[model samples]
Target: MAANSRFSIAVHVLTMLAKNCDGRVKSDFIAESVNTNPVVIRRLLCSLQEANLVVSQVGASGGTCLARQPKKITLSEIYNAVSHGEIFSPHPKTPNQDCPVGKNIEAILCRLQKEIDKTVEQKLAQYTLQNVIEMVEREKV
Candidate 1:
């Protein structure tokens, strides 16, 4: 199961905010760092806001800031924010239902997908943005 780039992008945004320590960081700066479009960043910001992972302020000095402390924000939390649908999307094409294996394949695949999602989320929950920052800082030469 492949996850979207939103997870990494969100981590980037949060880590940048953590370093700044200020109330907010503009989305454009974030977009530049992530090498993505400002419009994409804004859309992601909206989702993060809805998840309470981040908040937006309007006006000249307006931008986005973490809703909670970096140490408190888990990667899983970030994953949940921008992830809209299933973590593992099912096969788009329908399989033939005449065969026994074919009829039950979807059910078995779904069960496996759920298990994978749970395990992945559990692992992600162990790391917060603070941990990521520490790793990044340690890697600096």
Candidate 2:
């Protein structure tokens, strides 16, 4: 299965907004930078807006911009805003009870999955959108 990319894309969109800092950015411009369709960027924008991370406008000069400063926006906040489900999905159908490993696998994986999600969230929470912009600035030189 394809991994979910909404979290990363949302970060990119916000970073762009943080760096721009002066005016609203159109989704098409952000889509070009992200190399994705404008629709995808717009969808992510909707989710971020609902989380109060970004705001949008409509009309000729209307576009999108960050709702708050980059330093106040944590990566995990961005992650939670877009990531809807668990990182790992369980089997669609029940494994055969006839097999001992099959019977216990789901329970075992559930425990592991919880730990994994916690670790990931904790790590992501360490950084903010400002951190990302700094990294980009350093590398751009």
Candidate 2 local lDDT, 15-126, one digit each (tens): 9999888999999999999999999999999999999999999899999999999999999899989995487799899999899999999999999999998889999999
Question: What lDDT tens digits, residue by residue, belong to model 1 across residues 1-141?
Answer: 364788678788888888886767898898899998988898888988999988899899998888888899998998888774366677798777998877889998899988888888899899998999999999995
Kindly state the number of residue pairs that clash in model 2: 0
Number of the top-ranking candidate, with lDDT as the measure: 2
lDDT (Cα atoms) of all candidates against the true structure: 0.85, 0.92
Q: Which portions of model 1 show Cα errors greater than 4 Å?
A: 1-3, 84-88
TM for every model, in the order presented, reads 0.88, 0.86
Worst 10 residues of 1 by lDDT: 82-91
For candidate 2, the lDDT comes to 0.92
Q: Which lDDT value does model 2 have at 109?
A: 94
Relative to the unseen true structure, what is the C-alpha lDDT of residue 45 in candidate 1, on a scale of 0 to 100? 87
